[model samples]
Structure formats: C-alpha cells, structure tokens
Target chain A: MSSNTDFVLSIEDLTVSFDGFKAVDKLNLYVDKNEIRVVIGPNGAGKTTVLDLICGKTRATSGSIKFKDLELTRMSEHQIVRAGVGRKFQNPSIYENLTVFENLEISYPKGRSVFGALAFKRTAEVVARVEEIAREIMLDEFLGTEAGLLSHGQKQWLEIGMLLIQDPELLMLDEPVAGMSARERELTGQLLRRICTNRSVLVIEHDMEFVKNIAHKVTVLHQGKILKEGSMEMVQSDPKVIEVYLGH
Target chain B: MQVAMNKLFGGREGLVGLAILAALIFIIMPLTFDIFRLNLVGKYLTYAFVAIGLVLCWGYGGILSLGQGMFFGLGGYCMAMFLKLESSSPESTKIQSTPGIPDFMDWNQLTALPWFWEPFHSLSFSLVAVIAVPCIFAFIISVAMFKRRVGGVYFAIITQAIALILTILIIGQQGYTGGINGITDLRTLKGWDIRTDEAKYVLYFLNGALLIGCILVGRLIITSKLGRLLLAMRDREDRVRFSGYDVSSFKVFVFCVGAMMSAIGGAMFTLQVGFMSPSFVGIVPSIEMVIFAAVGGRMSLIGAVYGALIVNFAKTFFSESFPALWLFLMGGLFIAVVMLFPNGLAGIYTSYIKPRIDAWIQGRRGGGNLTPTVPAEPQDPVSPRTAERTPASAASRSLAAGIQSEPSRS
Candidate 1:
C-alpha cells in the first residue's frame, strides 16, 4: 500500500471509538484502481463504520484516510463526495419524495449551486443520461414512478444508480443487496462487475456467494479488526475467518 | 388548450387558484367591499405573505420557524419608522417639546431622534431597509443554526424564543419602539395622507398586485429543480449532503428567501393598517401565521393565500358578531386542521376535486388507458364539501399530475 501509487485509497491506523467501544480500531486498508473490494463481517463488526469514516460521515479518533492524494478525514461529507467518493447507506436512502428520473438527475455532476439548481433544466442530454442510468439499474419503465412506491429491491438498485450518475472514481455501498431477491442479487452482481471495470467499489456484504462472484479481493472484519485479507477461496480456507463469519 | 391552461395557471389546480385570486382582487373586492373592509382584506393578505413563506420553509424544507413574527415585525417597523418620521414634520409636531421628533419620543422625554431612526428619514433607504434588514437578520440566524446542523423542533424552539426576546425588547424600550402603542400615528408616506379613503383604495390595489407578484415568485421557486431538491432534502437530508451539495447553504438560502417574503407583507401591513404594534410581533401571531399556512394547504402557494383570507375573515366575523366565541373557534380550527386535514384545503381539493376533474377531462378525451398507480385499495370516505386528506393522496396526485400525463408521448 505504501509503494503502490496505483492505489486509489489508503487508510493508515484509522480508529473510531463510540463511548469507549472502539467501533473501527486501528484499521488499515487499501483499494487499488479498478479493484472491487468487499468487507464481510457479522453485525456490529464495524464494516459500516469504516465506510462512514471514509465518507466523512463519522469522524476518526486519530487516523488518516487518504483518497488519491487528498486527505478525506479532514474534509466534509460534501467535499469528500466532490473529491470522487460516493457512499450509499445500509438502508435504501434515495429521495422517496422525488421520481426515479429526478433522483438520478439530481445526482448528476453539474449545476450544484443554489442559482444553478434554480435554472437547472431537464435538457435533452439530461433526459438521455437519466434514461441510460434508469436502464442500467433495471428501472427504465419505472422512471416516472415515485421512488417511495418502488419495491424494496428496486429502491436499492435506484440508490446504486444515483451513485453511478456521478461517475465517481470510488463508490462505497453498505448492504447493497440485503433485502434483494436471488434474481435481484444476480442482476446486482452483474451490475457490480460492469461498474468495477472503470471504477473502484468498496462494499460491505454478508452473502458469501455474492461476495465470491463480485469481489476481486475480500477482507473479513471481526471485532473492529481485520481477520483475513485475500481471495474468497483463500479467506474461506482460513480457520479464523471461518470461525467468526461462517460460524452459523 | 393545454398551453393556454399552463400559461394561465402554471398547472391544473394552480389555474383555478389564479383565476379566483384575480377575480377577488380585480373585480369582486373592488366592487363589493367598502374601503374599510377592503383595507381589512389587505391586512389579511399581509399574513398570507408569512403563510406562503411558511409553506416553503415548513412544508418543503421541513423547517418550522415559529418566530416568523420577528422578521414580520422587523419589516413593519422599518416602514413604520419612515412613515412615523415623515408624519412628524416640524409643523405637525410643534406642540411636542421636540418639534421635529416623533410624539412618542417627546412623551418618553427624548429631544432628538435615535441613531437607528435617522436612516429612515430617506425614503429610498427605508424602502431598501424594509426588505434588506429582515433578510440580513434571517441570513445570520440561518447560517449560525444550519451550519451547526441544528434543526427540527430545536430550531423551531430557538426561533420562538427569539420572537419572545424581540417583543420584550420593543416593549421595554418605550422611548424608541413606542412601547405598547408601537410606532403609531403613521399618517403619511411622502406627504400623501394614508388615512383618506382614496389613499386606502390605492394602497389596497397596490398591495394586491404585489401579493400576486410574490405568489408568482413562490410558484417559480417551487417548480424549479431547486424546489424539487427542497422536497428531497426534507425527506432525506443525508442523501442530499452525500450528493456533493452543501446542505446548510441550501437551508440558509431558503430561510432567507422566506424571511424576505414575510418582510414584504410586513411593509404592506404598515401601509394599509396605518400602524405597527408589538401585538403582531410576538409568539401568538407568529404561530397563528403558521396555522394559516397549515390550514391553506402547506404545499400550495395559492392555498396559502386562501388560508390567510379565510382564517382572518372568520376571526373578524366571529369577534364582531359572536365576540366571546372567537377564541374557542380559533382553537378548534387549529385542532381540527391538525387532526383531520393534515394537508389543509389544498390537500382536500387535490384528493377529492382534482381527481374528479381529471376523470372528466379523460372522459372527454375518450379515456381507455388509465392504469391504477397504487395497489387497489378502497377509497377513504370523503365528504364532497370538505377536504379529504390521506397522506399518500397528495403525493400520488402530484405524481399523477406531473408524470402520468407525459408518459404517453414517450
């Protein structure tokens, strides 16, 4: 991680404590360009907290989170997003009050100021771009649908589509398919594969089969520390990794 | 026909609202109402300004500013200061010890105008100050509160506390703010006596036109992408923050804009009513203004106007004829509105009336392809005369209005 300039993100000794329960303790992680990295863990293992720290939603006690050359821990959430990092919450957090087209259109990387938004129009290009993303997320026919009316799985996909609209170099998603059907999960796996060709994805997922299908490298987190970091097959073979994650 | 309708109303129900407002302002009120009653309507319209502002702030931004009265009083006092100074010409105030100063100043043993009162001597400065002062005050409050991420009920309470502070400050400093009487004896604006009936009529018309302009500006904002973002932020603020937008900046911007709108109403109130008082600058009136917005349909600009007119009209009618029952009626109205009509008049109109009209229009168009958007459920029991508010009805109705009609072309 130190020598490789190809790395898009590097976290050095990152730690966060909530009432003395170290949620993410001295966590060291790295993701290279175009890499698809998945952090697998049981509940309260701080998989989500790590994403929160990287996205500037949660402050680190004392650590450094560097995205490319920019320091993320010091920046605000909006600033981190502008610096080419996008995050999706564990729950489907897309704007339910807006339509699918609007959800995607708002996430588009232009006209961000108050005055800009006042004059922002649904031009031919914007309409086309929104439509393209809607199709990619399998929500083409539902573009006119209010996002609140979408199925649980559909909303999950819409959030991913919203993040994709920005064309961010790095995307962080929490529980991308927690409530998704097997069919939806398969589609999401395919979507992840396509997206990771040009960008990086740092995901927190529990589905081992889904992880095996999408992750180029896997990191297993247990009790605020990394238990194993390797390929799916390599990590699955590790006794310590199996003991915590595959205990069920 | 569609283009004409859109041009006239901005949308379906908006056109209906615009038509009624135009008729009321231009034809009905001018013909039917006497100067006194017309002036009363003008006063009520002033409250409509604050109500409309509340629609944007509370309804869309999900920020309930319980102290909008602070901005309202700020604007009103700014105008009153100017008018009070103009009326206190040396000749008119010769009986007072301080001939050139306002009577209140003389009563409170003041010999010269206060430092803050000097700027109002210039009409241009007064006019600018009326809008600018409130906006600046609102801007400072918004930046301090929103930047720190303080919101929801906490913001509302702080605003209410601020209203209480301002009221006390104005009343305590009798020498400056005129105490309980406020900045009264406002007889003129640039030497034209506002007390005359002709002057009242002129001011009423001017007030109506300015209100229409404010409503149009509000319409422009709510229909813009910025408006949609406001709705989005209300529902999912973190999503908006993560979308690379400064959430606090947007909150501050809307807050200031709402303040400016309330300020305009305040100035207009001072002009038509011939006085400004601390009665309208405290917690009671501030919350009452919010109730007006809530009653009118928080989401609809047109509804806000109707809300102000109706609530105020009822207040005056009940207070004059039934006197003792007015307070009871007001309390009941607030309770009924909160419990039954969460969306207010506009919500009822959209839920019950708008759907029927849509059906009629579709019937005329040889309707065959109406697909049910929601999973088929029994319609709520609705009385035709009253507003029927189901939480989802407003959302679905607006959705149907925007998207359902356009999908066919694609």
Candidate 2:
C-alpha cells in the first residue's frame, strides 16, 4: 500500500470476470521504469485483459493497478491516458480519415479538452513535434497521406507514432507485429527498442523472434495466471511455459 | 491574411462556394421572386438552419439526431407565444371570460397566463429562451445517452421517440400549448406588425443573414482542430478516446450546437410564417430535415441549404400539379439520391462538375499559350502507374515505397 514504487506499473491480485468467468484471475505483474516487458501466451491466456486493466479499458472486479502512484482502476479511459499511459489496440486503430500529420498532431498531448481543441492553434511547436515523431516512425515523407491508405505495417507504425507523441510514462501494445512482413517486423523491433529508452513498454506478442529481439523480459500466462517470468532465455526454457504455450 | 481567410472558410474553393450561395440567397432569389415566393423561400431557408446543424452533427460527428424538429418547435413556439400574447391583450380579448390571458387559455377556462408563458411577454427573454431551452434539453438528452455510449441507430431511434413525445405533449396540452393547431394568429412583435409586407421582407433578409452567420460559425469549427477531431471520432471513436479526449463531451457539445441552430430556424419560422404548429415538431418533419442534409451532401454546409431549398421547391412544384402523387415522388427522390448519389448533390458537384470546370479552365489557359500544355501527372516517384491510380491510393503507394526503402536493422 506504499505510495512510493520504483516500478512504473504494479498490479497485485488483479481479477476481471465476465459473468463469473474470470478472464484474469489474481494476476500479480510488475513493470519497471524504462523496461520492455513482453507478455506471450496461448490465445485465451488473458494477455490482452491484463493490458486492458492497466489502461482502464476493462474494469477489474477485484485488485489494485498502481501506475506510478495513481490507482488506474478508478479512472476513466481518457483520464488514464492523460495520466501518461498509452495503449495500442490489437488491430491498427489509426484514424483512417485523417492525414498522418493530423493523426500525430491529434495525439500531441496538448489541447486535449473540448474547448482546448476548439481554440487549439497549429503552432510551429506542434508541427515540429509532429514532424519529429513522424520521422521516428519513418513516416516523415508520408505526412500528408491519409492513414487508411498506408500498408498494414505502416499503419502499425503510425499508431506507435501516435502513442510516441503523447510521451506516456507507460506504453502498452497488443500484437504490434501481427500482420507485418519480415522487413516491417525487423523495423518495428528497432523502433520499439529506440522508443523504450525513457519509458516502460508492455507488449503482447505471439512472434517469438520479434519478442527475442525487443523484449527485456518475458511473462508467460496460462488460464489468467503467470506460469513463468524471467529473462527471454529463462522464460523460453521454463518447462511449464514450454508445456502450456511453446510446446505446441 | 490570405492564408487566414482560407483557413477560416476552408480554403479558396470553400470561400467561392459560400460566395455563390450568398449571391443566390441575398441577390438572385430576392430579385427574381415576388413577395409571396420570397416569403416562401425565406421559410425554406429557416429549415436550412436545421440542415446546416445536421452537417456538423450527423455528417461530421456521426451522431444522427431525428428530433431536430423538436428543438425547432421549441424555438417557434417560444416566438409564437410572445407574438400571441402581444396580440391577445385585454382589449382584443374583452369578449372572452378572461380578458388578459391568451385566447386559447380563455376558451379552455384557465384564468391567468401559465407561469412558463409569463416570461414570453418580454421579447428579450423569449428570444433567449428560443435558443437556451432547446440547448438545455439537448444537453440533458446527450448527457444521458452519449455518456452511456448509446449511439448510431439507437440514438437516432431515441431522438425520433423524443420528437414524437414532444408532439403528443403539445397536442395534449390544448390550453397551454394552443393544442394541435399550435400557437397561431400571431399579430405583432413589440408593436411592429410582423404580418406586414415590409416586415416579411426584413425578416427574410435577417433569416438569410443569420443562416450565413451560422454557416460561418460551422466553417470555423470544421476548420479547427476540433473539426478534425469530430471526423476522427466519427470513424474511430475508441482511437480518439485513447488519445485522451472525452468523446461524450464533444458529442454533447455538437448536439447542443445543432439544437441551438434548429431553434434559431424555428424562431424565424414563427416570425415569417406567422404561426407555430406540432406538424413541424414531430418525427416526419424531423426526418424531412435530415433528408435536406443528406440530399445537399451532409458534409457540405452550403449544400445543405441548397438541399433544403431544392427539396422544398420540388415539393411545392409537385404538390401543386400532382397533389396525389407528391408524397410518392418525394419518397422516390430520396431513394434515388441515396442509391445514385450517396454523397448527395454536393458530392455530385465535387466528384463530377468541379473537376470538369477545373479541366475546362486549364484548357482555356493552355489554348492561350503558344506551347501545347500537358496535364501534370501526380508527383509520385515510387509508383510510375500513379497516373491511373486514384489520388488517395497514389499518395499511399508513395508511402509504401518510403517504408520499403527503410534500412533494415542488424
């Protein structure tokens, strides 16, 4: 119950049930500052549910999700975002109708309120920030392109760039490389490592090669409980993890 | 200065579109139409206010409200109440059992004016009520529904039900609301006879000016960051929410703005038409208002105005000649517009007419030059076949090339 914690996010006894069916049951997970933790498991392993709990998407039935010093369970989605937590959906969720620059500008962490957005001026500072994030995601030249027109991989990158603009303290991604080609996967790995320098990242992935390249640590989930948690090599070698997840 | 103007009015093209619409409403229509026709056009323009609001709400925000007529009715009734009270002075109603109350109240055996109607005696209060009452009502409805994440067809259905409820309530309260006939026989507005020809002309111009002003306000919102946000939210509501926006608040705000605009139109309707009725505040008229927006091109402000004017004109024309088949014709027209031109008249203009006009202008310039001019191909180096690709895909393919050329990480 201490207010102080070295970890960026701490979850203890987190449980979310849908009509008495517990999706995430008594899960205890901790993500440290500037760490990239990957959660990998079978289809119904509750990997997404854990991220949902952290970002206030799905309310927890019983538990505490402490993001820094704040209790995330009580806050709304936007409030959770403003408190410096960013989430990317399983599917690339960029605004298709908006241009790349606008997609980034909309997520620039300023003018977030209704009236603020109304009076928001597209100042040089905002343009510069948008350009910076666009270049980081390798989308600098495609600033004027509509987001919907981007290839699957580029759309994923744009979503990442959107979260990057917010500069959130804790970043969560669900299947960042689900539909990506090999080259797109490699570029995404490099992008993830580069962006994780100053923030904590929680990524859900089924691609072992991509996970090995970017994950600092790995947590294996089985039926809403963690079966193994360690370095990539450690989790990969764990007999229980191998039996429940990787063995198949 | 030029850049600022472009930003305010959605670029030079938008400004030109607006100017053309202004010329039609202010100069051409007034000059060509007789007083009777002009007054009718003014009435149609009042509905345009509701249509314009729908562009912001349903078109941009993706919130389709089928109860705009309720807000419009609220405004019209407010204005009508004021006028009716003015004309129903003690001298005018001396033969009635009660000399000071509205005639409808006297017939229903009510002694004094209802407490709510007492404020309508003050023109300023009634004028404010015309906008504020509908907005407050909209705020409540939107907060209750949007906060619960009730939207799309459910929201539309709920609004239709609310409009129906309001119509029934007005009809049931014959004493207070002047019954099904509505608040009619409105004679004056603060001693100025609104029924006079000069008053009608002034009211028409005022309605036109106010509509133009509303369009300008809408343009301002549409061109701002908020406008982009509305478009973004419409397509991807969760994306906007995750990006740190209170999505419901934006929905509520736009819905209120739409309500306020509809109320203004309703007030103008009362003034020009000299009455208010439940027929204009129910489900059918509300759907008709939505048709105006859809036919005009829901996304285009000026198009909605033209939509209202054109549809109403068609109605008048057809109803006059083919009175029995007018309803069938309207239904058929709506179906055709949806099937053939989903983007409505504005969409047709932009997709077909505007391009041809641009090409013709280019050809004229080319003809004047000594050298033969070739049409410029899209500047997409990545895709040589971009000349055949749609502009949207060409831009995206160029982006695909950018990603393909990225250096692979070791």
Candidate 3:
C-alpha cells in the first residue's frame, strides 16, 4: 500500500521465516516524518525482528521496506544506514574502549569512505554537534568518560547520542529504557520527544509508562501480525491488544 | 593538523618503537657485529615486513590471516623469476638443451619455457607482479569471505586452506614453479651481482628503510579515522556497519594493504637472501609470521618489527648453539609470550618502561612533580618518548604522543 509522502518509512507485506517458523508474517506499518512511533508486544511477537528487518540486519524473506523512494529490503545494512536510517540495538552497543567523545565522533556521518575517513578532520562544527547531542542525551558532562565506565543508564543515553550524531532521517531504537532507573526513564522519554521534532523515531519498548509518555502513535503486534494500531489510549483500550500485550 | 599528524606517526610509542628499530638496524647491530652478521640482521628484517603487515591485518583489523607467507612467497617468487631469467640468459645457459630457459626448468626436461615463465623475461613485469599478485590474491580471498559475512575462525580456516592449496600447487607443478627447491640460485639483477659484499650492505639498508616505510604506512592507517574505524569495527562490527561504513570494504582494503606490505618484504627477502624457496612459503612459516605480530603488541606496528627481529634472532641464536633445543625454546617463547604478556614486548615497555621514561623526562622538566593532567589511568602509564629524545621546544607539543601510545593499552 502507498502511504502518503509524509510517511518516511513504509513496510508492505513484509514476511520473514526461520526454517518452518515465521518470525514476521505479512506485517505492514508506516511512520510519518517527525512522528514518534512505538511498537510493543509480548516476547516472541517479533517486536525486535521488525527493527532488524527494517535496518537490513535480518533479511526479509519477501517484502518491500520503502524508505522514501528507496527499497531497503535489497540494500545492505551499511547502505540502509547511509540512506538516512539508524538503528540502536536492544543492548547498549557503544564502544567501551573509546571515550564517549570518540564513540560519538566515530558514528558521525560525514566520512564513511576509506579515503574520506583518512582525510576526515574534527572541525569546530563537528565538535559543537557532538556536544549538542551529548547535552540533549544528558551525557555532556561525561564526554571524556570511557564508555565502559559509564553507568547502565549513561551507556544507554550514550548509545542514543551516537544515533543522534548521525542525524538519520528515521531513527529506530529497540528497548531504549529497559533497564533505566525511574529518573532515567523520565529523561529518556523527554529526550526522545525533543529529538523527534526534526525526524522520525521508532521505538520498541516493554515499559508501557515510558512508551505512553513518548509515542504519538502505537502499534501492537501478536504472532508476527499487527494486532492493533491507534493512539496509545485507543491501543490500550482494545481488548485484543490488552489480552496479548498490555494485560501482562 | 600538527596534532593529528603526531598521533598518525605513533607519537611517543612510535618514537620509542622507531628509536629501538633504528638502534637495532643502524647502531647496535652494525657496531657489535661484522658485516656478515649485519647482513643476517637484514635477513630477519624482511620478516619484520610480514609482521608489521600483520599488525594492520591481524592486530588492528582483527583478521588473523594464517596465509601471509603465501603473499610473501608470491612476491619473492616474482623477483626470483626475474633474477632467474636474467641469470639464465641465452649466453650463460648455452650448455642447456634450451638455451634461454631457467636451469630448474631445463633440469626437469623442459624443452621450451613454460607459458607462465614467459612474462619473467621483462623485469618490469616481475616487479609489478610482486605487489600486484599478492594484493590481487588477498582481494579475492577477503572479498569472498568478508562479503559473505564469514570471519573469525571460519575466515582463519579458509585462509589456512588457501595456504595449503598454494603450497601444494607450487610443489606439485614442479616443472613450472621450480618444485620444492623453489626459484633458487638467483644471481644478478640486470648485471649487478647481488652476491657481492657491497650489494649486501646496500640491500641491508634498503630492507631496513622499506621496513620503516611500511611501519609509517601502518601508522598512517591506524592513526587516521580509518584506523580508528578498524578498532571500532573490531569491537562492534554491527555498530560500525550501522554507522554507515561498509565493513567488508574496510576489511578488504586493510587486507590488501597488508598483502601489499608483505609482498614488498618478500621482494626484499629475495634480494637479501639470494633465493626464494617453499621453506618460506608453507603453512609453518605462515603461522610463524603470526607469532611475530603476537610477540610484538599486535596493535603496535613498531612493536611488530622488533617482534619479528627478536623472534628470528632468537631462532637463529638457539638453533646455532643448541640445535636440538631450539624448537622447544621457540614453542616455550610463543606460549609464554601469549600467556604472560598477551600484548607482547611493546606491552611491557608501555606499561612499565614507557611510564618510567616519561616520569624521568617530566621530573627533569618540572622539579619532581608529574603533571596532574597525566595519569588519568594508572594502568596506561607512559608518554613523550619523542620529547625525551628530542629538544624540549619541538617536543613539548608531542605530549599528544601519550594518547596515541596509549591506544592499545586497554
């Protein structure tokens, strides 16, 4: 189905199966520009798999994932990222060996080619951008901190800052606040809202309160299929969504 | 611009590494040993090429290719082919049944030169092939494996298999490849007799210079963003790929660069040793090359040269005096190096020697008080091998060397 031009990411009839079992079955979803969408489901309901499929980490057995005019199913992970899409892993995947500043700098989008990377310089513009993202993610003070030394909440924020550094048009994060303290979850909710002002944010989270606080719209998946799609209140009110996901 | 270049050249660790290598090549070995022994040191430096390349591919890129000797052999064979062709000139080999063909080819009852050996008639072609062949081979292997998402042990296994295949192919095609004896008895390079003592000294210095050049190239790659990308890619492959870098392409490029480095070493080895044989091309030598990188800090390119020379020197020293115990000693050295100091000799220097050296330099400058900005991490204690050696005015700016030297400490 052709979603409106405002929708930056649209999936049509996406299906992927491992051996005889289908992980994602005929899933269709779309998110508009600057809209923060969250997909929530019980475990094994293919919540994370959707992000994987969108990011080209998991190959779609058969489907079309269109980011604007581009068909992402055919592209590789790096190509998809270059095409203005960024995905964060469920676990914080920040570089522990490098400092927070270096981690953010590496993820910045200006230089990806081998030669480009060799000649890359850290200009004032880049430093200002990294600092700005760090401030947004509340990691500005920890710029010199080795990422491995960061608290679990700071590491999670740092990962978000890394994605922000790339400034992807459509950012996808899986379980952004799964292990955060209550204060961290609150700050992350606000951070997601602030970052989504210019682009799209797709989050997969189990923390209902955090998801409700941030998501403009919610999609519920059950058995690799969309079970409900509506505003957070409407989705929560649905008996089927409540039975499969929210009731837990 | 100045700061970036300093880090790129290995800064303090690099300065220390360069200083040590210079001492070994130009000063210590030259002064202590006669020309004969110095030439032997030249022989060990060739492997330093392979080891330094390993620092790029295995240590930094994290691709443990157990087939570096394949590239080295190919490069050496190219040079050997050129030398062999020159030595087997129509005038020199008039006694042979085929006047123009190499002696080994003639001995194997070949009436005509093999089609593959036809290109060796041009020294230019042989020279190009020395770098091109190994790089092309590495490109093929890396593209096939890395593109397919095959790495770690599987990639290592495949590379080892490639080494096996090459050795078998070279040996089995005895007529074409000079058999297990390999391309040997190489004499002159275009009428310049390589066997002369004068030529030996020239080749030795040339080899040392090329080794330094390769170290600089390694420094260039590792210090640049591409180098940091290699470190990031190794630690978090998906993160890098997701960061919009083509991970496989980076892998292929570094692998090719490493292969090219080894080929130069091989060409130099052919020049210095006067022969290229299967002894240097087989699975054992291939694995032995990895030990050179490991015995040096795999992450430290300068450490790699020292690693290669030290290991080879020890090998020669032990095998000469206690021939029966040499193998056991090598085995123990490798095991002990791996178990006790996984970071190798460079690790010891950085952790212990470099810090003390830094303190001595700093203590002299600022009356017994090390700067507070330094020692952010107690474990990574070292700096300014450059500043220590050079005058304070130019060297003061090189404390950036501390960060560069500290890259692999973690």
Candidate 4:
C-alpha cells in the first residue's frame, strides 16, 4: 500500500501509560483502506494496547488518533464504533444466554432499534445476511445453538461476524486466533483475507506464522515502540524482531 | 406449531400471563368468597407488583436494592396520610379523642394538617403522589450516590441508610405521620366506597394492569440494545463506560424505574389494606423484597414473581399455623435454597418438577433426579489489577469461553 492510498486510520504519537508504566509510546502507524496490517510483538510489547487505544477502550495518555479525519481519542468506544471502527476483543464477548443468530443480530447497527430487537421480524435479507456470515465462518449449522455452547474458535468467529454485521470501515482484532485449533486458525486466516478485501484490518497477533499468513504489512513492536514496519520478509529479517522473540 | 407454542408459553409471556391470571383470581374470587379472603388476595397482588419491580432491579439488573421498602413506604404513606385526612371530619371525631388525638399524633396535638399534607386530600393527587415521591427520592439519592461512583456493598449500605432514615423520620413525626399504627380507618377512595366489592375489584384489576405494563416495559428495555448495555454493566461496568455509555445515567434510570414500581405497589397496598405505617417502609420490608426475588431466582424475571408468590404464601401459611417456627422455617428455607439450589426455587422446580412431569408422560418417571445443578462457584478471588490480566490467560485456555466472564470491577 502506497502513502497516496486512502488511509482508513492514522495514529500519530499515540502514548498510553498505566500507573507510570508506558505500555504504548509514541507509536505512529496508518492502516490503508482495504489493506491487512499485522502488529506483532512479544508479551507486554503493547500490541493489544494499540488496538485498545484505537477502539477507545483505553484513553491514550497523549496522542492523535484519526479515523477518516475524525478524532477518535476523545470519542467513546461505541462512538468510535459508530464512526466505523469495529473491534474484536481477544476474548469473545458474545451474549451467552442468546442464541448464535441472536448474537449476530444484536451487532447489526441498523437492527438495534428498541422495537427492532424485540418485535422486529427478521427480514429475508437479515436472515440471508446472518446465514451468509454463519456459513462463511462454518457456523451455519450452529445457528440454533446457544452462543454459550460454542467452542472457543467458533465464539471468536461469531464475534468477528458480529463486527462484520455492524459493517465497520476498520476492523481491529486482538489475538483473534489466540486459542484456536490449527484448522480453526487457518479458517480464521481465510476469513481475515476475505474481510480485508473490503475494509482495513489491523490485526494484533503473537504468532509469526499466522502474521506471515495474513499480513500484507507487518509492524514489529518492542518496548512500547514500533521497532520495524515493512513486508513480512523484511520484518522477519529485522534483528530486533529476532532478539525480542529468540534472544532477549 | 410446537416451537411457537413453546415460545409463547415457556418464557416471559407465560409468566406474565400467570401474573395476570393471579390478578384475575384475586379480583373475582372475592366475589365468590367473603371480603376477608378478598382483602388477603388484594394485598397479595400488591406485593406481586412490588416483586415485579424487584425482578427488574435485582434479578436482571443485578442491583440488590435493600431500600425498595422506603420507596414503597413513600407511596403508602402518601396514600395513607390522604386517607386519614379524608376520614377526619372538620369536627373532631371519636378516633381523634383517643389520647386526645389520633393515637399516633396525640403527643403533637396537631391542630392543623401540615402544608405538605394539604394536596393529598384529593384521591388523584394522593395516587400520583404515591408514584412521584418515591421516584423523586430515588432520583436524587441515586444521582448523588452513582455520581460519586458508589456501587456494590457501599451502594447497598447507603440505600439501607436511606430506608432507615425515612422510617425513623416517619415514626418521629407522629403529628404529621400516622407513626406506629400508621394511618388506618380509611373508608372510601375519593367518592367511591372502598368497602364495596366492586371497588376492591377495580383496585385488583388495576394492580394486574400495572404489573403487565411494567413487565412489558421492562421486556422492551431489557431486550433492546440498552438491555445489552445494562447486562454489560453487570459484567464489565468499566468496559461499558469505555464503550461510551454514561454509567451513572443508566444506574439512575434503573433506580428510578425500580422506585416507581415499588411506589405503585405501595399505592396498591394502601388501597387494599386501608393503612400505611413506618414499619412497612423500613429495612425489614426492604430485605423481604430482596428475599422474595432471591428465593425465586436472581437471574430470571419470572423467578422473582414466583419467589414472591411462593415466599409470601409460605409466610401466610406458616405464620398462621406454626407461628413460633415461621421465622425459623423462613431462615432454614433461605439457607437450604442457597445451598441446594443457588439459582433458587425456579431452578429447583425446573430440575425437579418439569423433568418428572415429562417422565410421567413418557412412563419412565423418576423423582430422585431433582437435585438442582449449582452454578459454578465464583472463581478464586483475584485483585482488580491481577484480574485485568487474568482474562487474557484464562480465556486463552478454557472449555467454557463464553460462560466464564471475568468478574467485573465495579
């Protein structure tokens, strides 16, 4: 992705500290429209903190976070979402008491009017959309199952589908495949590729192989700062990346 | 057909219908029986309305309010005070002669009704007063408390203090308030004779209608996006805050709604019992309301109604029959239910009754399989700071990814 490409989000000098411990420091990055950007880091390298800051989960200590020219640092998480940024927390947050289909329905931006959730009849389009998302995530068969009953990976997929239904312009996922089986991980990778076809995706993952599989560009974070930002090969060849992962 | 029927009769609709049915029986059975039975059922329906509010506040919203009785009392006293005034003629009556005044007010020798008591003379004013007073009180207190970010035990204690203060204030103002005997000798509602069976029936029907309206409103709100936000408030309040919801606003909304419902219940109680006193609006009544919901099931709306009816029925039964042991039995029952069925009577019935009924129809009945499954015990307590990082690891490895949410930091 070139600098001239329409960027969905730009983070400049983003600094977030917890109790004097700097978790994210002066980070600058931009996610180009319809591009897949992977953020890789060792534990405590502030990858999740970046996503958290973008989604308004954590207030940036000092920073400029712009999504399509709208300032996101001052907005609430839901407002950020409404402003077209969707996030999938590392751990699934689907309503357990609700059915799988109901979970997806709640996340649909247009389908959440007070009357709509309780009394609104599911249109054929809604049914089709839900089924389509479920089918893509291999969850079509489990539509009737309670979301509480889904496997770990399936829950993650359902959550991702939820974000998709919201139709956010930028999707930020934190360790989306953290606990998935190999098969489920591969499916998630494919799902990310499909999602990246339309909207910008900033994925934070610890797994280098997973990053290499889905990343169009990889940014390596070490000690709360971006150490490297380049193609997968370039980032993999970076000495800091090897030192953080293997040596120091 | 099966699914449709199941949906209709298996969930909230079914419970609400049952509540309406109980209300109907209360209204009609009085005609079939004597006024004594009529009054009893009428009073029960009033309590049922109170329980419905408790359901929303405690059961779903996860706020175990111990001050609902204060709100209830606010409404009750509003009505009772008005009724006392209406009953009192300009010329001193015989009841006023007792202790040289109405018994509770004898000490004060109150020659004139207080300025606050003047408007309550009209039935409409008193009726509106019942709902409004409690709501305003709740609105003010909740705003103060929630703004300071008080929650959990502190919230519960502050509410308890409010109830206590109101109770004491009412008790001390015997001249203005009815005090210990509260306000009794209520004869009519406005121009209509409350002694009439039709009058009692109207009150009963209104109670039923109000309950239904409340349930519907609660249903609409809880099932909406706001409901999700409320539930999220219970699970991850900070997350919800960061999600951009004004947490204080949501808390106040729930508190006001709960207070209004209790006030409505109190108004009904005054009409049914023809009296209201400080005792009814104290800590004991508040705790009883909580117990009613807890015994039914804290997480389920229908369970609150069931718990209210069952617990109240037991109170009526045991108090009359085994007076000395009634409290003992109530305590025992609470302990037993908490230990045996942490989810409460609803869970017990689900595990025990429904299965047995199904088995009997299938001709493979077994009553022994009724032990309720205990909800997973609270995960070993983790400090808030540690708790934050634990979700990353705990969720990274779990059989039940969806069920085991990290206990929220309040």
What candidate 1 gets wrong by more than 4 Å, as runs, is: A1-4, B1-9, B322-324, B358-394, B398-410
Q: Residue A109 of candidate 2: its Cα lDDT? A: 88
Candidates' C-alpha lDDT? 0.86, 0.88, 0.84, 0.72
Q: How far is B124's C-alpha from truth in model 1 (Å)? A: 0.8
Interface RMSD against the true structure, candidate 1: 9.1
User: What's the lDDT for candidate 2?
Assistant: 0.88
Q: Write the residue-wise lDDT of candidate 2 on A1-248 in tens digits.
A: 55448889999999999999999999999999999999999999899999888887899999899998899999999999999999999999988766787789889888888899889987778888988998999988777765766788999999999999999989999999999999989999999999999999999999999999999999999899988899999998888888988999
Worst 10 residues of 4 chain B by lDDT: B384-393
Better of 1 and 3 by lDDT: 1
lDDT of 1 by residue, B1-410 (tens): 65334433476556666878889987898899887788899899999999989988888888999999999999999999999999999999899988999999999999999999999999999999999999999999999999999999999999999999999999999999999899988998888989999998898888888888888887777766677788889989999999999999889988998899999999999999989999998999998999899999888788889999999999988899999898788889988998998889987877677667777776667666574423112222222112212224546545454553422221
Arrange candidates, best TM-score first: 2, 3, 1, 4
lDDT of 1: 0.86
DockQ of candidate 2 against the true complex: 0.56
Model 3: per-residue Cα lDDT over B1-410, one tens digit each: 55754765555555766877777787787779888888888888899889989988887788999999999999999999999989998999999988988988888999998888889889889999999999999999999999999999998888889998999999988888898998888889989999999999889888888888888778777767788788788889999999899999999999999999999999999998999988888788998999998898787787788888889888888898999998788778789988988778877766557667778878888897847534235233222112211111112213334454543321
Number of clashes in model 3? 0
Cα-based TM-score, every candidate? 0.92, 0.94, 0.93, 0.81
What fraction of the native alpha-carbon contacts across the interface, defined at 8 angstroms, is recovered by model 4? Answer: 0.14
Listed per candidate, the RMSD to the true structure in angstroms reads 5.1, 4.3, 4.8, 8.2
Name the candidate, 2 or 4, with the larger lDDT value.
2
